[model samples]
Target: MTKTVRIALQGLTCDGCVSSLTTAFMTNPAVESVTVTREPSQATVTYNSAETTPEALCSLVDDAGFEGTVSES
Candidate 1:
């Protein structure tokens, strides 16, 4: 099954941050797509639930030197 999550992010300053995070998320084969916004400081990620979890996705963002929390809505 595929699941999509919206992650609230902090410490993003530029397009480079977006590109870097997008690349990081894509490194996981389970990730289907990633869309990041600078103004809102959030990322929408679609991935295979069987292969990954929302927590794991947040970890990816954190590992990229940013703070990420799974948005409830």
Candidate 2:
């Protein structure tokens, strides 16, 4: 199954920030797409549930040097 998760990213202040965020998600084999907004500091990630979970996705962002957290909203 596929799932879409929205996460909040803190400390993004430039376009290059988006580049790293994009790279973080794309590195995961199960991630289908990643869309992040700077003003709102949010990312909508579509991924395969069987291969990856929302928590895992958030970890990716943190690993890439960003402060991130998954939210119900």
lDDT of each: 0.95, 0.90
TM-scores for all candidates: the values are: 0.97, 0.94
Instruction: Specify the highest-lDDT model's number.
Output: 1
Give lDDT tens digits, candidate 1, residues 33-69: 9999998999999999999999999999999999999
Candidate 1's clash total is 0
Poorly placed runs, candidate 2 (over 4 Å): none
Candidate 1 Cα lDDT to native: 0.95
Best by TM-score: 1
lDDT string for model 2 (1-73, tens) is 9889999999799999998899888999999999988978889999999998999998899898898899677
**CA RMSD per model (angstroms):** 0.6, 0.8
